[model samples]
Target: MSAPSTDLTQEKQRFELLSQEFENSQKDYSKFIAARQQLEAQLQENKIVQDEFALLKSDAKIYKLTGPVLLPQDKAEATLNVDKRLEFIRGEIKRAETQIADCQKSLESKREELLTLRMKIQGV
Candidate 1:
């Protein structure tokens, strides 16, 4: 093969590889976005739980959901559990956001490379 044909083949291979990487990254970002949304929903529900627990009287009756049964549970402990869950969800949200940002940066960079490669191929 001529030098130019060989170079073109290599560039074409690189272009396909980069395209696949872009698609994979896009899928990862989509998954993270869905996870973040789910976490946000859980956080909202947990907030409602926190509010409900806060409004309860110290002596008010509460129940823990044991499978097939509502077992009596301390109000304070339940409130604390809900608070912990909310904090955990908040941390997850922050992490997910960070991952999303990184993924976006990678995606954009790969896109620019793809565009350059396309132009290169066309010029050849």
Candidate 2:
């Protein structure tokens, strides 16, 4: 009947919309994963630098590369800067992790919605 046909058509439209949404969520999830990975790498590198600082003597000459110039830096100051950088990187990593987790949840929910919509379309 025409009523059944109408229901089928509506369900198909809904399925299409859900499919698009799921695709978009997948893209967002990928982006979040990339960002989280980059943040983790940065955190690891900073931790390595922090460890290196421990091997250096207090009076060791340290230089900071600022663009094209190597500026002399006091060891204490450099260590402090590295410590602050590590803290900031750790905070950023936590934030990225949170975003990744939230995006993963969104992706899972959208996937479920798409599957349900597919079933409805088939039934119609």
Candidate 3:
């Protein structure tokens, strides 16, 4: 009876410890998921900005050439304006690309953290 009682006590303690560890892992995973979602949103925003920039670049090219062909002097000024806009868009695209790279790094880090936690929990 004593042996049985001791075994039961040890089992209960082990169970409790395991439960606590599972809870902690759950919390950490939750946080990681949230961060991943935010990173995904930012990536999406970056993609949208990139798309917008591409469209703006296309518009600038079209207008710059058409303006010059149709109305030389007026088109020259318009082309200059379009060129300026294109330059601005290019700069914005570069910035967005940089941000995307940063987000990817953060996402990878979070994934690695989650994987490490899971492996630790599994006793691997």
Q: Which of the numbered candidates is closest to the native, going by highest TM-score? A: 1
TM-score list, all predictions: 0.96, 0.91, 0.47
Cα lDDT listed for each candidate? 0.94, 0.85, 0.56
Clashes of 3: 0
Winner on lDDT between 1 and 3 is 1
Worst 10 residues of 3 by lDDT: 56-65
Tens-place lDDT digits, model 1, residues 1-124 = 5999999999999999999999999999999999999999999999998888888889998899899999998888888889899999999999999999999999999999999999999994
Top lDDT prediction, candidate number: 1
lDDT of 3: 0.56
Better of 1 and 2 by TM-score: 1
lDDT of 2 by residue, 50-109 (tens): 889889999899999999999999989998998998888888878878887888888788
Model 1, which residues run further than 4 Å from truth? Answer: none
Task: Report per-prediction Cα RMSD to one decimal.
Answer: 1.2, 1.5, 11.6
Candidate 3, residues 1-124, lDDT tens digits: the string is: 7996676676556556655655665565565556556555655665564455456543353322364474333434554664665566556556655655665565566566556655554557
